[model samples]
Target: MEKNNRVIHHPILGDLKFRSLINFKFNEKVYSGFEGETIAAALLASGVRTLRCQEETGTPRGIYCNIGHCYECRVQVDGVLGVRACLTPIKEGMAVRSGEKLPAPFKKEGDA
Candidate 1:
């Protein structure tokens, strides 16, 4: 069995195909996703619903509008913060972290 089977196949539009799979990390856990797909789409396809939590209320949040309108899917990508998963495209070796607050900056090799 292959991944990305969750992509809907339209009768008129034909089969929806994704690009080559790329490796990404979420909270240090590795996951595979296709190129050009939004981070939220990849996460949902992988069964990850909880994208992050409210900063003040600490309530769980996930993909709501799936567009840039909703900020529910905010996640930390690489060392940056407040990146919208629904609008951000997945890239190879991207590190994504979801939490109530922004994650600490990632340290590179030989960093003090």
Candidate 2:
């Protein structure tokens, strides 16, 4: 089964049916989304609203402000830490992960 997370028509951008569909992995699960869209946008479209949980209280958090101001949409990409999901454009085969539960952050895997 194929799931489409993109809008079929846009008033400004015209038809979105021809946009490039790319596959990306989020916390080990593969999802298809349009290339060049923000990671937060793609995730939201795929019904994933919780980007990460609060480190202190474990409260769920997703995109807020939808810009670069607030840090609520932070996510790890390609082993890099704290990349803003709303500002960063997702690419094909990209590996994205939520912040608090990630091993690289908790274990400091590369630190000696």
Candidate 3:
């Protein structure tokens, strides 16, 4: 089925039609979501919001902006962490997870 970026006619959210349902694995748990839907949205629909947090504060974070500006919706997809879940699309067999810490900013040796 063709993918669309509308969430008004979703099957689960009756009358809200969303993109075609697709299967994906979140932290090894099988889940189904729509094709153009954000990873965070799918997780939230499935009752999952805690994706990851800042290493220093340990504060709970999820899709705060839903726009990709805030990094609160970061999650690991297929072993890659620090990815904005609100910006990534759901795909069949995609692997997603939480509790990932972003890598430290790279610094040039002896450049300090």
Candidate 4:
């Protein structure tokens, strides 16, 4: 409760009622966020900045280019990998976790 990262009082989007607060699991921990918000938004509100790590280096990566262009906020949802948290809506009881960096879906010609 001490560390609230949510911008509850913004000049433009002022005073959201937050009537439909929903609960979901992130990294085996329970977190509550407003319904209808994207998973990325919810996680941000919950003070979770590091969504995932670099594929090879394992450096922390959070929400960048929140419009879904960067793909830096990709996370696993309900056991599915490579889900764009910025685009995916947070569902009640959904299990969200930091995704493991996997190889690209398609391999290059020389790749085995």
Top candidate on lDDT is: 4
Model 1 ranges off by over 4 Å: 1-5, 102-112
Worst 10 residues of 3 by lDDT: 1-10
Error of model 2, residue 89, in angstroms: 1.0
Ranking by lDDT: 4, 1, 2, 3
Per-residue CA lDDT of model 4 for 64-96, tens digit only, reads 999989898889899988899999998899999
lDDT of candidate 3 over 1-92, digit per residue (tens): 42333456666767954567898988788877887977887888877768886765677777789988978888889988688888898988
TM-score for each model: 0.81, 0.79, 0.73, 0.84
- Each model's Cα RMSD: 8.1, 5.6, 6.6, 2.4
Which prediction has the highest TM-score against the true structure?
4
Pairs of residues at least 3 apart in sequence or in different chains that clash in candidate 2: none
Model 4 steric clash pairs: none
**CA lDDT for candidate 4:** 0.84
How many clashes would you count in candidate 2? 0
lDDT of 1 by residue, 36-77 (tens): 988898888888899888775578899999879977788999
- Per-residue lDDT of 68-109 in model 2, one digit per residue for the tens? 998888899999988999999889999999887433335355
CA lDDT for candidate 3 = 0.77
Could you tally the backbone clashes for each prediction? 0, 0, 7, 0
